[model samples]
Target: MSFRALLWALGLLVAALFAASLLIGPAGLSPSDSLAALIAGRGEAAALVMREIRLPRAILGALVGASLGLSGAALQGYLRNPLAEPGLIGVSSSAALGAVIALQTGLAGAFALALPLMALAGALIAVLILLGLAGPRGGALTLILAGIALSALAGALTSLVLNLSPNPYAAAEIVFWMMGSLTDRSFTHVWLALPLTLIGWALILPLVRGLDALTLGEDAAAALGVRLARLRVTLVVGVAACVGAGVAVAGAIGFVGLIVPHLLRPLVGARPGRLLPASALGGAALLLAADIAVRLIVPERDLKLGVLTAIVGAPLFLHLIYKTRAAQ
Candidate 1:
């Protein structure tokens, strides 16, 4: 298909999924009524559901998914690593660790920005440490190994926090939050995440040209006038905001980043810059659909959104690994 057609299809899919999200809750409202409630603030119950619940959820799903997708594409494109994802690189896990600490230590409850701020700090720390461990000139093998070590360390620390929690309810809450879900989220979360996520996007979007140049290799990209140090800083801070804010509100939703960009890569002719917006829209659509599926799959059970994504993403990831090995 043509590029225009592809954009149109993705736009339509996102629009449809956004509508589905607003309408698919337990409230039993029709699409028309839900849209009406969202747009015109008509009817009490519908208005409450639309304004207070589903609207924020849908908006967040869009923002978070876009952030993940955009970050994943940026990372993969810049590093030239097919498997570079937020979770794989320790960003998500590190952010999760911080948020868990905040929750366990009662810092989150004491301050509204505690979770996101800590999560952001954790992400920044991960990026700094990863860069130090692997260096800016590290190969894919070195990067992956360093990332694995960091992820393990973050995971271990997060578990330690959970294990040491004196309050059983807090421990349970930590576990549930780690599992990840968007259920019953409010506008407070929406507002908390929006500014940071947007800032991240703004920071990363301009690096597309640099990302494209880097495809020719660091030296070649530098010859082309791409500033590697500045680009790296932009990417690190930008990804921290995106992944950190996302983990802050959504609690570790994984693979929207990993899967969305890969799926859209070919459609965008594998161009890094072209892939960003496409991946963002694709991520939003995929996440909204997944969130809807979890809601319907076990309405009473309330399946975690992260569970479904992991189930689908893990095997696909394994397949990619196999394919990469076979090609080698």
Candidate 2:
């Protein structure tokens, strides 16, 4: 199918999934009932369920998914590596650690915005360290290795904090949050992350052209009038904001950013410029679907969204590794 056709199809699918999300919750409202409740504006239980729970969750899912997708695409384009991802490179892990600290220290309890703010700070720190380690003119191998090292360091720090927390309950809570789930999310979360996510999108959306230029090689991009250093700074900031806010709200959900971009790249003709928007839409759809699936798959248990995504993503990673080895 053509890129336009795939985009249209994916858009329709997202709409359909959104409707399902509204109507197919544990309380079980039919489409007709949901529509009636929405239209009547009465004190109906179905309306309350639709409005208070499912609607906010679905919207938040879309926002989080879009943020991850866009950031992933930008990172891959900027680094010129298909394997590049925000979480894999330590951005999301560091952000999660910051959020965990905020939560454990009671700062987040005092102020709702503390979590996202702290997470953003952590993300920026990780990005700066990664860039400093990679240095200018660093090759793909150096960057990847530096990212891996950063990720390990962040993971160790996160583990240490969780272990040393005085309250076992808080430590347990940190484990659950680190696993990444959208269950019990409310409008408060939506309000906290939405503004920052939107701002990040605005900053990154204009960089698609620069990404496209970089694909021809950074030196070639410079020749084509792309200011390499400035663009890199913008990309890093954009990814930090989006990924940080997302991790703050959703915890450490992995692989959506990595998987969504690559899955849509083929349909979008493998062009970074075209892939960006498509990946955003596709990511929203993918995560919404995954969230819904998590609820439905084990309704009693309430499976985490990240676990489901990891189950799907790990095999794909293995396949990629195999392909890389074969090519070598």
* TM-score on alpha carbons, each prediction: 0.93, 0.92
* TM-score quality measure for candidate 2: 0.92
Tens-place lDDT digits, model 1, residues 1-328: 7767888899999999998888888879888888888899999988999999998999888888888888889888877777778877788889989888887789989997888888889888987887777676545667778888888898788888888998776566555555578888899998878888988999999998998888788899999999899999999999999888888888877777889988898898888978878888888888888889998999888788778878888787787778767877
lDDT of 2: 0.80
Cα lDDT of model 1 overall? 0.84
Instruction: Report how far residue 83 has shifted in candidate 2, in Å.
Output: 0.8
What is the overall TM-score of model 1 with all chains considered together?
A: 0.93
Candidate 1 Cα misplacement greater than 4 A, ranges? none
lDDT of 2 by residue, 1-328 (tens): 9878888998898798877777667876667888777677555787777777778888888888888888888877776666667777788889988888887788999998998988888888988877777664445567668778877777777777877888776666555555677777888899989877887888888997888888788789999999988987887788888888988989878788889888988888888987888888877888898898988899888788888878887787667657756776
lDDT minimum window of 10 residues, candidate 1:
170-179
Model 1 lDDT, residue 283, Cα: 82
Winning model by lDDT:
1
